[model samples]
Target: MARLVYQPQSPLNATLAVSKRWATSLGIWGVGAGTAALFLLSVTPLVKREFLVKVPVVGSYYEDKTPASDKPF
Candidate 1:
């Protein structure tokens, strides 16, 4: 008679395996959503000042180039 080997599966192991499988997909979705959100908010003053203006390549594009004396308030 051949003996059967039983392996115990832990919940932690199951969770880790699932997370590993989905990690890349989840990361891509998150990054895409974040970039979309930033673009949608690009017209907002707060978003431009706090985030867009800090981006090295596009910072100058978002910067307020108008002189203070323009006086629109």
Candidate 2:
């Protein structure tokens, strides 16, 4: 009868597997963050400004009756 032998798993192999999983997780998180930033940029305006108004009846007040964005929402 002939003897059979099998090699034991190495620490390097386990380390490599763990590293692969970590890289994949970071990639997914980065993609999600990028997509969220892009959506926010598209839906919201880049510039925002407001000015104060003086009226006899209203006294001093801010101009918030209309939107501050250049384009209409």
Candidate 3:
């Protein structure tokens, strides 16, 4: 014979349950915001060196091919 245990859900569980309903929408919005941020920051050297340059397909596109000596500044 097995005894049944009753467990009450906490507020955190309730919040998580509600959030599950909006998960897909939230994910889409998050991705859109991140993409917009990346695009807006794309011209910055930090973003270019740290992120855009590591993207596989377009990595070569962002690579700086110029020799250091060729730069005027």
Better of 1 and 3 by TM-score: 1
- Give candidate 3 regions above 4 Å deviation: 1-13
Q: Write the per-residue lDDT of candidate 2 for residues 1-73, one digit (tens) a residue.
A: 9999987878999899898989989999999998777556543333112211343553233334555675466
Candidate 3 lDDT over residue span 38-71, tens digit each:
9999899899999899999999898889999999
Could you tell which candidate, 2 or 3, scores higher by lDDT? 3
Worst 10 residues of 3 by lDDT: 57-66
Q: Clashes in each model (backbone N, CA, C under 3 Å)?
A: 0, 0, 0
**TM-score list, all predictions:** 0.85, 0.34, 0.74
Candidate 3: Cα lDDT at 25: 96
User: Per-residue error at 26 for model 1, in Å?
Assistant: 0.4
What is the overall TM-score of model 2 with all chains considered together? 0.34
lDDT of 2 at 70: 58
Each model's C-alpha lDDT?
0.94, 0.60, 0.94
List the candidate 1 regions with Cα displacement exceeding 4 Å.
1-6
Q: What tens digits encode model 1's per-residue C-alpha lDDT throughout 10-34?
A: 9999899999999999999999999
State how far residue 53 of model 2 sits from its true place (Å): 37
Best by TM-score: 1
